[model samples]
Target: MEAHGPHADDDLVTMLTRTGERVPHPDFDRYAEDLDAATLRRMWHDMTVVRGFDNEATSLQRQGELGLWVQSLGQEAAQIGSGHALNGNDFVFPSYREHGVALTRGVDLPEILRIFRGLQHGAWDPEAHRFHLYTLVIGAHSLHATGYAMAMDRDGLVGTGDPARDGAVVCYFGDGATSQGDVNEAMVFAAVHDAPVVFFVQNNQFAISEPVTRQSRVPLAQRGAGFGIPAVRVDGNDVVACYAVTRWALERARSGGGPVLIEAFTYRMGAHTTSDDPTRYRTRADESYWAERDPIARLDAYLSSLGELGDDAREAVAAEVKELGRRTRETVRSWEVPAVASMFEHVYAEPHATVDAERAWFERYERSFAEQGVHA
Candidate 1:
């Protein structure tokens, strides 16, 4: 389905336009009005910084610095806007490719690169950052988020009218994951318990090479309706729309409104990962079509029109992004991988006979490699 202006019948909410226009919305516009110049500028910075680092990471993967890389190239607005809407205390669960969300949460570059570089099972502590480890197992994180939110509810911490104490959970995933039983089960559990969770699905038009049509007869946003969750579709390319919609959803969940689902209508501009080839599965025409709706360009246009992003400001932001990219590249290159034996050390929280036996066998196998003069 094609994206359109915010309307109840169309079910697509568009507050910002690709041509640097602002869609008329009496309610949603309040969120934009409350945004100061500095905040808008920061959003612009966040998008550029994420884009710059994303490009650098992709390059590093091509250069063999990483085993695989997933680019958040075109979906920056969807991720960044929603990411920024969360408070520091609100927990976030991510799929493997939510680099933009990690950046928004103030995670360091090397910590994010460590997993793709095959160094760590989890680089950052979820309890510390309120951003959980990247859940590479597709839809598993949704269940995790729902469970956490349910705990928050049981603790009576969600609707306390306190910013620092009241917290909601945001779960990020792609359109394809919605088809998984885990995601559906999560939605059911969340709705049934009135869990303080917002399901943010970035419908990037593809689940690998398969189009979204093959995954659902209706739009993915409507999937929540079957489970009694309120869902809204947003123009994912428009950062303002994404932020406003996510803010509304999260606030609703925090205030005992139950789980809300937001389908961020977006397009993936690159391959599914460094190992995949977009040209083999997608068309050049599709790229051209989404190119015109580039989120960064749209924000730049609005900023430029308002004299907030003059040439000097643009140059300044560009320089900062370049430095960020450089630092990210350098830090990732300098990261040291843990020793192979260290993996076995953390296999169990407490020692177990089976784990000890496996570790002993693994050590024996490694020692044999040295004795046999093997290249392992």
Candidate 2:
């Protein structure tokens, strides 16, 4: 598949160029006009920190400290920008690779690694953070998010005119997930019910080894329009555009507008996961093309031009990034194996004869290891 860089399309909503130049948008520029140098600097810090965290996770996976890792490497701007636009009460349902979104939601970085380290089913409280546990099943959470949005609407959360009480839902999934039946069904239900939801599709150009071209002949943004929902495509590498577009979509959803779809045109820039090999299916030339539009670098350049990110600010951010990597490494290494019996504890609300018997057998099997002077 031929690579389509951000500059190739004029229709893409954008506020920043590949070379980090700030540009104006007729419709969307007003949304970002309120963003001063301070806000932009904060955004730069966020994107830089998350990218550092993502890189640390990748390294951990390679070092065998983590069983697996999914990177948000090149797509940091799409996540961090949209994440910053969310209201505190708004809920987010994310796929497994949404580490940047997790960071923005105040989820403890180490807690996110617990699942990948095989220590727990889920480590954080979804209610506390308003960020649901990462869904590993492809496209399943789209239905979950839609159902939640319907519930929110029924509970008088929609069109309330009260910003504090009104809220919307954000459902994030990858380009590959667009092909799933569940995603289509979710969109259908969301549109029919006029649910207050924003379907955030990060179109990272590839679904693992399969190119998006093989999946659809038309732009993915049209899928939302087909369901009678408003849709917009943004240059996913442009942080300002992402923030503006997401804010617009969320406002519509919160104030009685139905479901909206945002197709973030971006690239993955790495393997789909630690288990996949991009080198097998994609060429290095394609990787290099996206690298020029690297979101963090682009934002850095823009911030530098405005004199918002100088040597001092860069040094501070670097220190923070270094500390984050150190903390993550320490935390992952210090994790102790949870008791084996803990798994059986949450299998059911009430004790069952079958579960009891299985637990008893497992305990006996575990004791067998102790008898043989081996760790179970």
Candidate 3:
């Protein structure tokens, strides 16, 4: 099926295609220069496998193994593309549904599940992967990223004229977050201070049942203009475009070009979370429309053109992903829940009047459970 729909644009920054065709483009192609056959293949394989992991996570939620699962089903390219554009020292502040980005940053899949399973606040170290824990507080992490970027400038970690030492910040949020005061304020701070941060908005169309149309009068990309941040809108499903656009923005930020905004026009193929019923709000027709524009299918077709993705290669990837799914399921089952008192342990890490009282009260409650023979 060819492109169909009312709003489809022919000039969309599409390089790879659903057919085995790689179109030539000055901007989109140059950024993909280092994407040798192996790297392109890896991108394809990573998208496929991370999508597999996303599916398993959703299944586990359905089966009650996880308390909630935020599906990255239709938005894989947006996450992985921008994610791969980051430098090693670049810090990432992600919204809740960035599983693909987490995979790119080498975060353990089980640790990701731990957050959704309600087993831990955030199970991994941010410093290890340079990827912060999921921030479900809507677009609030944008402020965190901005503050971190400012701190980097003060610490002389950025704008030292050394690509090897300079660090930048990438903050992820959704179109829904644009309606937030916190997000707008962060933009203000970023532009005013010229913070080395990129505000990456994954405009996945719906902010839970409300469509993007209801949220903004103009394209979300224009929002950055008010704050003086150069903004660009990219076809988020096209991982190549996403990577290129984000790489440009990140490099600009890293080079002390200040903050940039990238509006990734993608769709959330699944519910807001397992708790959401997208069927109540969105139509099947809309889903079908985007299904034809599936990111994985497009890249796979491009890879096939190069004869890089043979049947054997696909089979091997499928087997590896199957094992990954199996491992994730088992890990979810075998994982231990944290102790109740342990919550208070992290509340302060030091003695505080109010916290101490809360801890003492919590301990008393636990002792009461023991006295009542409530041992598990």
My TM-score estimates for the predictions, one after another, are 0.94, 0.94, 0.95
RMSD per model, one decimal: 2.5, 2.2, 2.4
Instruction: Compose the digit string of candidate 2's lDDT tens values, residues 1-376.
Output: 4434322345789899999999898988878877899988888999999889989999999999999998999999999999999998799999998888898899988788999999887889999999999999999999999999999999999999999899999999998999999999999999999999999999998888898887787778878888999999999999999999999999999999999999999999878999998999888888888899999999999888887788999899899999999999999999999888888886787888999999999999999999999974
Q: Estimate the lDDT of model 1.
A: 0.86
Deviation in Å, model 3, residue 155 alpha carbon = 1.2
TM-score result, candidate 1: 0.94
Writing each residue's lDDT as its tens digit, candidate 1 over 1-376 gives 3443221226568877889877777667776666776787889888888888889899999999999998999999998889888887689999988888998887875578889999887889778888999988989989999999999988988898887788899999998999899999999999999999999999888889887777876778777779999898898889898899988888888887889999998888888999888898778887998899999999888887787887777788789888987887889889887778788776777888987888889999999989999976
Which sections of candidate 2 miss by over 4 Å? 1-8, 348-357, 364-376
What's the CA error at residue 228 for candidate 3, in Å? 0.7
lDDT for 107 in candidate 1 is 85
Give the clash count for model 3: 0
